[model samples]
Target: MLDGQSFLISRAVPGSCEQESKWIYMTQHLLESSSNKRPPSQESEEQEQGDRGKRKKSPECPDTPDITDTEHALDLSDRQGSDGDYDDANSFINPLGRDITISCLLRCSRSDYGVIASLNQSFRSLIRSGVLYKLRRQMGITEHWVYFSCNVLEWEAYDPYRGRWIAIPKMPPNECFMCSDKESLAVGTELLVFGKEVTSHIVLRYSMLTNSWSPGIVMNSPRCLFGSASLGEKAIIAGGTDAQGTILSSAELYNSETQTWETLPAMNRARKLCSGVFMDGKFYVIGGMASNTEVLTCGEEYDLNRRSWTVIPNMSAGLNGASGAPPLVAVVNNELYAADYAEKEVRKYDKENNAWITLGKLPERSVSMNGWGLAFRACGERLIVIGGPRGSMGGTIELNSWIPNEGPPEWNIIASKQSGSFVYNCAVMGC
Candidate 1:
């Protein structure tokens, strides 16, 4: 509901030729791209036309313009300088010298304000040594709630603004209420949690206003370690291990309005611990382990409107373990990113060009156990990594905010409690 304005700030050295040229090139790119798009709104279009008419006519060029030739030559020199300066400047900045800090405003009910404040203070001390790049307020689902399968299947709402996590009423336990490696996705006011116990199944509906969980529908097949994402009004679940411990290629969809689960076409290959993201109205499934025998290079996509699956380019590196859970696939500046659990590297996928590039490596080693409960969210404009194994729970980092002059940022520990929270398989709701 917050329609805040987004701003960009640049602080390069004054009059630096490399910085100036790069800025100009980026501006030109934006101008050309905008020109090809649809015209601005009617009022803005009229304003633009009026401004054009008000411009004074330029003087006619002489037989040979004095500045034209020099300008043309300088353009070529600037282009050459751009390439060299980019490389030189990048080399000068250490890849590991950057630091980022992430802050979140915890809002809870008036009764639980003190608890929320404690969390905020604890988080501040946890990452006080690092730079903060992200700050987000957690979205509350009714009065302070937390949903867990093993427990009473309760719901709690946390108010980051008030600093509280309040527990809501309990839900009726269904026939099979157990879910391991549970993954949840949020669409509007509904939360969809999918997991596998003895069967691969999904718990469809949880409303923040209702403050309770009700059975909406179940998946066509039960799956574990699957990837889930929300696109518009629908939630998509794809690629996971079935009851038999075999990786699965199938996918399912749940329409929030219809309150039903429908089968979509399966993926190209069986994958568990794969990363999935919904971007530009499509679902992208990336790397994971297949059959416990091989790490998969398979990637696929499902069209929301068409209800079809298509094989897409695979990831640069295969991922497995805790790295393939709910928030693994993150969209930063229109590009898809996933941390390769097996490779300990982060990769970015360019949807426009169908290419994969290594963004960088994780600050620490990879963790392979209980690969679930990892959560990633955009705090402000920076991507915040939270709650994964191998020093991840308290660990946080910024995405793509680094520049050549600024160097690669460091991961700051945000929450160091020994709660041993599963980073990959947990549900995250943020404002």
Candidate 2:
């Protein structure tokens, strides 16, 4: 297996005093609370240590072939430090104490967690315990990272907040996966990549906690070319075709916390190549092929509380071309938006009228082939478009963004890098 050095790039992002003051207040509150805490008993330490030990390191894959690393990627050995091992596995920053250490670390950017984990065993154990992220969620602190793949076997994560790129480890070698079409979704701290093996469909998952890829738990009914979306620790997968080439209306809900899948009530329609999104506390599946030759214009909304599907007619009418890819759509702040590939324009959904209003043109350089290679997603409050200019000889891929408002769209180029192709799959993980 290739133990290539993970890539890191830093760009200065302007900070505001208001944000800094808020952090100071939160840190002070946590510190004050810690000062009133009593000493932990021996049983508490043992239990906490055992919980950290439960996250077994994934064994290296055997017979894995090596792949070339990207240019400028660093080596893992060069990033190591000389830290003495801690006698107490439960200790986190012995000098500062666990509570104080956690309070300080919470103020740090999520992009720095990987480097923090390398400080010592205690820090590593704390990260893998998943407590910091849980606490972050409770505190309403979230950082959105865009995880995308331009190559079949490799993935890169972009931290828009810090303007950094992290190269993930190469996936385990599988001839079947290398050539097959794949789908990707990021739920909680895990990135799930769905593809097919020789005889069956499989899921390969990459976890931020482990910083590694492993075979994932499969769905109750394994399918591909489906519509899927994630909300916090849960994700829903709807209509698609099974391995036997049968279109299915069957759906399944996955809980990343439990690492299990629950079969969901089937959708009203069976379609393949559809796209999914979460809006207003509901899951929506839009635009796909109902059969080999027929395209679907209607969309379905799945209500979790009622356990039912509602079909919205003309929900995607005129949005998808007859032979085009799945409707390129995303949701930000519970408002829906779609990219009109044929028109090179952006449109927003009017919830009250159940119609789409054309907003403005997309980024001039953001090109796509029937919406196949381009990715439209909501990274927090911004609507981002990821794609490269059209050419047979591929070049740099660009990430552009625009915050929706009453004014016309003014796109800003955030990041770009040389690549042979546009994004094959992409997902946003907010933690």
Candidate 3:
């Protein structure tokens, strides 16, 4: 029988030991350079916290040593390794080349990445460099995880693939942020939660790589209640009211790789409380209030290749009510689907006819307040509905899903837990 190391090598490379040994190591300097520094989000948070006030420590967000301290330790490790104190441990795997090691790691479930990073300095560096995830993307290997908040300060993630729930670190306590309206979006490996803090707006970011929350970079417009959507490593926010309470036609695009926002061409009409989605390789903004009293029935499409917007009349007809939340919309396989909260039904967009066709009813027990507290999103290949049942004594949140096909909808109750009946925010991250 093959030994343990030989078996692992065979599984990763699928050939003789000679073939496995041929795999060349990735450039050491590149890996170290990418992973050695702290993420910009963390560095910014440290500065912001000092400017704001002393933060109260929570159980979930225990105090972590500064990245500078960690860097010092790494320097010591490097010196010791040069002296032969830890020659083998310096490599990602003891004897196997890094190229082969990363091949096996890419096949491992994403849920195990956190645990794997904790094993040693070398493993941690590889994971933090973000190379592995980028390579995985190029290979078209991905897993989708759902992130949502039931309480003001708490967030939870559900791994649909593994059917496991993960508790995210609690957001820093702020009276203004806790009580204000918020919106959420997941781009790349970061989950951004936007809210108002007193006179100005603030963004709190949670990084999957670090498993920590930090102050995020604010947009150029710095508005609330905007329509936003993500595609791969980038996200776009469009058509929301500025801090001055003026409806804005301005928009911005965010690139997670650079952690920067680039201003985009404004839409034809200014609106707020709209919804955004990516479909058929284009971005669409639909159904929002033109002003305090004027509700817009039109939708706008942005063509990335052309860098322009086309206004489609009556595209969002009857979708947004005067006082309801933004139209609950999501896209799967380049097809648009929306949740009709008032009608308690699911509808598909008929682009050819410029209309919506009712598919089926929503979950019977799922409840919402004028479509405010319900989350309807596309989770990979399934349509997901997250909400609480009506008339429950205390509170209970349920996650129901259905894979769309030729037939009508038949949802499966995947998970439920005790929490506030209302969802504060929700976003799905596919990576």
Candidate 4:
């Protein structure tokens, strides 16, 4: 049986501040006491100079992301494209007939993006142009779907808003990327499954726009049991064992837009069964093994712009080798929170104090499970925890969720299942 090291989770895409301004814009309006707009003179418009200079301008909204397409790409064996999903003729006019309104409505049912894209050329144009997603941001509308991957080539999704399990396409094939030791996450509206094909590495992409599964671009190195995370519209892959089971220190960055993988400098130490995360505009590759039972107690942080890695303090406790899963870590309000398996509690790391402080306990059954296939994922504004005993051995599964933004967060049992997979990976696909 795979040990606790095998349980390392492929992390989620860390949220960015790019959309925070938009969310604030809407929330501020909602808090207003009057319906009518304030007089221009009294408004806090940065363009309109105030007594105190430019009224301390708010951050500018980020530019819309782009997806590139190639008409003939057989030269590339593992690439797929949807002609209209991102085309400019996108979205039906909303009730208010405002493009932003239309974008919000479209975002709510992203499962219907492909169906709607086929409805008309106008919708195709809008969807393809990336403007619809841009509008969704402007409106501060977010929709996320939790996707689960079980061992027997089974895949299922849970829609939190609809409160039900949603059907998804079956797992593709064994010849493709394998997730035995895996990483999965959503980038924009697509779920990117990152793993290696035994020894050959590759990424399998499932598009919410196309409602289809297809081969992804490529990976610089095909190593399984590695750590992965999403940051700034790309996936960062760090230390893991290669085909021959060689622990590796090399890393790379995958950009979906250009369908390219740019190799980054190697980390300070070789690691297998490690975890990577995107926090505070940088990528941090955490604990893992460099040799048999030779645990790397500390970690290294990568600066995206500087292309460098800085070692941080060692973790209070490393993932339990016998637990069979990665220690879960989450980012809330730019602070790092991790599951301290050794202590059977959830703790947050204080970089300044260099200490781990307990926040809460693991779910009742979680601690005893040895972390087999356990998952703690960031979904929209909350975290979703899923897993249980290795299903092949037979037992029920659990789903728990929490919105850390709410003070003194509480966990809610989202659901349970009599039959569940020995989870390989889980990610949140969102608009």
Candidate 5:
């Protein structure tokens, strides 16, 4: 006989097929059940651990707690009651049954907090709305452009972005007969043009709104080349040349609303080519040529409210020609600036310290002829000097340029054309 294991296998091989199949099925069932009950695989376990590590390293979410009604009501109650003491006997009593009503206290508390949050949101909305409203108001009206006129009473407007001057239509023939001069002052939308053409002193009012010229009330005295100042709705004309070549010390005011003229007390000295500036509700007159055969170093102030003249300290040097115009009397850094003809320099008068200081030298000589017809204009923060004859050159001409106090300062030549003989009345256009 064969060994016991070989003899048993041979016997079951063909005859025990059914039992072998049952045994195989039982073994597979046991193996599957055991696998189902077993722990995870090592790779899967390591993957889960990696995921946990990533989650642990990640940042936590920010705190955003939800406030409930009961908490809010408690806060409000605490705020209202300072001492935190409550009397049970004095407490409000509810008529409805507690269980039947389910006590709307929570609802009431929720309503109160809701109202508070709503009010806060509304206040913030109102503030934002108000700021937007103000910004819109400011944006509605912008300083779009500015025009300048030098001679012939002509104005040229410029488009800064386009870098070109726009031509305004000429005044009508009948409307064009009015006198033009370099002594005119433009304040806001009104132009106060004064001239002594014949026997009478006249003022022509040019309205920027209407774009037309109308005859204003005549002055009490016949004058030309006078200095003027605009205060509020009124204009003050002072110190000009009379028809008979007499310097005028008298001053008059023009009211825009009433279209009337009022005469004020005369200045202390007769002045021609004088400069007047309106500052702090008063008129300050600077240097000019006087009738006494002397250039005036004397300065005077005319109070608009008081209607009186008080003399101030003289300028460092006498100023004549168009330098007596308001453009020269620029208030920079709380100080008055004027071109000094006597010193051939720009001078500053400090109102706070009450002193005069020479600032910069002029381009030309200190002679009176060099200074005559020189127009000064305050352009932005710089001073612009327009067309004027330089010295006794007769037919020679000088261009316009700007002078800044600080930074890189230089003269920018505008025009070099000969201004012809006796070019004593030059004006700037579109500046």
Candidate 6:
């Protein structure tokens, strides 16, 4: 046998084996149900037992924090002496480097995220940075997900590719969660659930990457039943009711980069409980109940380049007397779609002839709980509709996905769940 001095370098740099062993343990844990953590696999148990009798102490990483924080990457790199140790604390290594690794993770489906997110802190930090999402655009990984909160406050997301449902982290607990039919907006890497605190008006944002909720920058005015839309990194909210429950015409823009809100010129017509949609690089505020008895059909357009708002003509004759919350509208490939609560059908906006085309009716037993029951969300270039047709107060609801590009649309029932089935709000991320 070689002497200690001669075999020093061959002993394997300190705790390399331990690091490899831990990675295997965590990966096994990842494959288990997210609702419960599982023990290491039998292979890992056997490996641990075999090594137990021959175990020998190795040099420990000095000043080595748990590596749970973002700064740990730098710490590990520096400790490894120029060339970092081969033991990457992260899950997988991309031969191309960290950028490629991030892009790969971003390209993964949302259902995969839950498993990956449970793997390690480094993975979480990279995802939360929103850098991967930007890379996704460059790589054209635009698989979208439809997320909605139903009878329960917690949100659930549907993955079109997988044709399944996965639970998202719960919103931060609040005594009184103020949610409107269209209050949820997905901007940048985060989803903002706008509402008023029990005692005051406040907004809460849930970050998908971090898997935690954080207080969002408050709006200039506290409003309920507002029109909201997201344009990737930025979001806008306009024309709702202010504190004390007064109707509002004010509008504001949110910049995720600055984490602040900026006031925009108010709309020409005051609208309460209106719906907003982003189409053709413009924001449109559609029909809303102007008063207890009157519903406003007039709509307005915000031209970001012009920094101006122009009043558009009233909607097609069908929505002339639209009541309650604004119609449930979603934009897919620059075309606008509105869900008709009365007819339970989706209508496509025809710009050329200025008419609404009846696409198809939603699945039977959908609940138009709040006029916005047909929570419509744009998934990539397709559409995901949530809610069943006029079901019993407490019953099951279906999540349907439709691809407009595929000629006439057909509903693919992706999931069914038990609830009072009243969906207060829904949003789509990873677009």
> Candidate 4: global Cα-lDDT?
0.58
User: What C-alpha lDDT do the candidate models reach, one value each?
Assistant: 0.44, 0.74, 0.74, 0.58, 0.45, 0.62
How far is each candidate from the true structure, as Cα RMSD in Å?
20.8, 12.6, 11.1, 12.6, 34.3, 13.9
For candidate 6, lDDT tens digit of each residue in 1-431? 00011011112133332342343344344334222322221111000101112222223211122223433333343221233333453433423344434433443444455455444444444444555555444433455666788754587766555555655666766656634322778877677877766546777787665666788878888777888888766888998877677788889999875688899998988877677888888988887766666788677899998888988776634452434446778887788887777777888998777678988776566667446556777776566777874445666768877767535568887677776466777888753
Write one digit per residue (lDDT tens) for candidate 4, span 180-247: 55567666556777666644666678765445678877667767667777643477888877768888
Best by TM-score: 3
Is 1 or 6 the stronger prediction by lDDT? 6
Residue-level lDDT of model 5, residues 202-234, one tens digit each, is 666665433456776666775776776554346
lDDT per residue for candidate 1 within 229-292, as digits (tens), equals 6543466788887677777889988766466778888887877877677666678887777756
lDDT of 2 by residue, 289-385 (tens): 8898888989999999999999998898777765787889988767899999999999999988889999999999987778888889888778889
What residue pairs are clashing in model 5? Answer: 148-430, 150-427, 150-428, 370-391
TM-score, prediction 2? 0.80
**Backbone atom clashes (below 3 Å) for every candidate:** 43, 0, 0, 22, 4, 6
Reference-based TM-score, model 4: 0.71
Better of 2 and 4 by lDDT: 2
Q: Model 4, 28: alpha-carbon shift in Å?
A: 25
TM-score of each: 0.52, 0.80, 0.81, 0.71, 0.52, 0.74
**True-vs-predicted CA distance for residue 358, candidate 1, Å:** 3.9
Steric clash pairs (candidate 6): 365-388, 365-389, 366-388, 366-389, 366-390, 367-388
**True-vs-predicted CA distance for residue 47, candidate 5, Å:** 81
Q: Distance from true position, residue 70, model 4, in Å? A: 17
lDDT of 2 at 377: 88
